[model samples]
Target: MHPQQQLALALLAYAAQRGLAVDRLARQSGLDTAALLSPTHGPLSAKQWHDLWLNAAQLARDPTFGLHFGEAATPAALGVVGQLVQSSRTVGEALTHGAALLPLLTDQVWLDLAHSPQSVWLRFRQLPTELAASATVVDHLVDFVLAFVLHELDGLLLERLQPRTVRFPPGARQLPEHLRVLRAATLAAGPPGEYSVELAGACWSMPLLTADYELQAALLQKITQWQAARPAVEPLRDKIAGYLLANAYLGIPSLEELAANFSTSARSLQRKLQAEGTNYQEVADAVRKSLALHYLKMGAYPIKEISYLMGYNELSAFSRAFKRWTGHSPAHYQPASASRSLPG
Candidate 1:
């Protein structure tokens, strides 16, 4: 299925809760009502999902609109992870297990951990198709991951839920109370998909969350087994993402260039992409889209500067292409809002 279809379905659910009908929103946004509603039913010449959401956000005057679907419903996969975390005996154990289980839920998302003398860093990667859903997916995934771990370990909520920016709507009381319950130290919403916590570096000083290494091992084995049972198809998608990341700002290359980089001919490259259910242009655009978001978060440069930095030749073309990727104009992305929400 087209990843946009999944996003549209999530948006449709969110709209229902806001008392805003999708059909009306579609009309207001100049979206093809049928296409927006049922993109998978037929081939959509235009990317209606992103366009409509952008329009709705513009009309609603909320930059964060369509970025996050409200607490109207908990997505099933996230809920499953939440439940699994709650069952774990300790915070550390829960985190280890949850990290293990991520692949089973969505290959589109991954979590990794690294520690140095100073800090333990948790990083996340979203698949190209998962990029648009980053706000919702990352927010929920981080919160739920912590909730399960902290809940198991401390029997309390997280001390803080800090994001790069608080993208919630005005009078968003849901956030403050949620933070209080979690004991969040600072709940700023700077960027999505990342967070930090204060921790002592001594892993040996910490006790294991559970004494049952055997049981924990068994559960982890089951999760890995489940993941292995699925076809290893998403790795192909990750390869596409990896290629884009390597080439995102190098300027758009022809199929020949891409093929040469892969040590293959253009035909072989085309066949490989086709087998993975994508094309060269689509992958390039996806890379551009992800970079656009990254640049938006950077917030120091003007939109035009960002455009040039992203490899576009002219301001107008960059604006049009950005709109094509994200549905919002560069000027309206509100870097200040993002800045206020980031951690030091």
Candidate 2:
């Protein structure tokens, strides 16, 4: 879930553009604004990135901040991935290349591109279900991508470009004026899984003004060299925790599925968890408890919705588990101090 520094700086810059209190937002997010202002910073975890998004929007009182931020993004603002995309031969090639390059940006999210008869659908979803708590961030993601694609191909078209349609999760807020500035874009709420942007076929195949193969080759080699030196293996417990957190919304994966995901067998996975001083159920419950406490403390959704989000069919079932996990039901867990923890 490590994201490049530019991702964080984008929000901060947006806040500054609107004249919000940068110091206060930094303090609220537990980020050091001074360090972040430097050109030399490292990657941020999924939670830290989310904190930046939430803090900026909250402090700015600008829910459509991401749209502006995305609209203003340049190759420099997005880092090497953006630069690589600009060097692609055509807008279609950029989309394909972007799908591959997205992993270089962040490992905690998924950027899936699906093609239809007359359009290309770009959908983004957070890998960790816990990260989906704030739907406002989804707005930023969709707006950002839409603006990004338009920027790359803006010269190919005679006029400004816009997505054919934009679909967001059930809970995200929309601002038509944001999209109206470039061109008309149909915006609507759909399912609660991913944020999507639908680009017409004509726009997809349009040529880019800045295509260059030699530069792209050099960047690709640099990226490949970096990947070649990654850690040979990751900790078994961390892998399990990440998997559990990501899938907890659908339902914790069965031990068999979990093992299969990691190319191991169920018994082997169980033994590994034991070697790490924990078991599968313990890991699953711990993840659920963590997400539950997060939502309860945020106090954004109702108890029933929180239960459904945590993968429970009945609120009573979630209440029972909360009682067992924290010696209190959802009602009493409102006090931030009432929330407890389990080893992650």
By TM-score, the best candidate is 2
Instruction: State TM-scores per candidate.
Output: 0.30, 0.54
lDDT by residue for model 1 (1-344), tens: 33334434445544533435667776664556556456464322233543555555544444334222322122221345545654565445556666776664444457666555554444555545633543443444344444433333432121222322222222222354345324555554323434544333443124443322232233344334434554534444455455445323224445664553343568887887888888887887776676666556656445664565456778888888878777877766646655432221
lDDT of 2 by residue, 170-275 (tens): 7666665455533546777867877777777676677765422332333334334434554545467655765455333234556765554444568998998899
For model 2, the superposed segments whose C-alpha errors exceed 4 Å read: 1-3, 37-40, 129-133, 155-158, 178-185, 211-344
lDDT of 1: 0.47
Clashes of each: 16, 0
Which residue pairs collide, candidate 2? Answer: none
**Model 1 Cα shift for residue 214 (angstroms):** 27
lDDT of each: 0.47, 0.63
Task: Give residue 298's error in model 2 in angstroms.
Answer: 54
lDDT of 1 at 154: 37
Which runs of model 1 end up more than 4 angstroms from their true locations?
1-11, 23-60, 66-79, 97-109, 115-120, 126-344
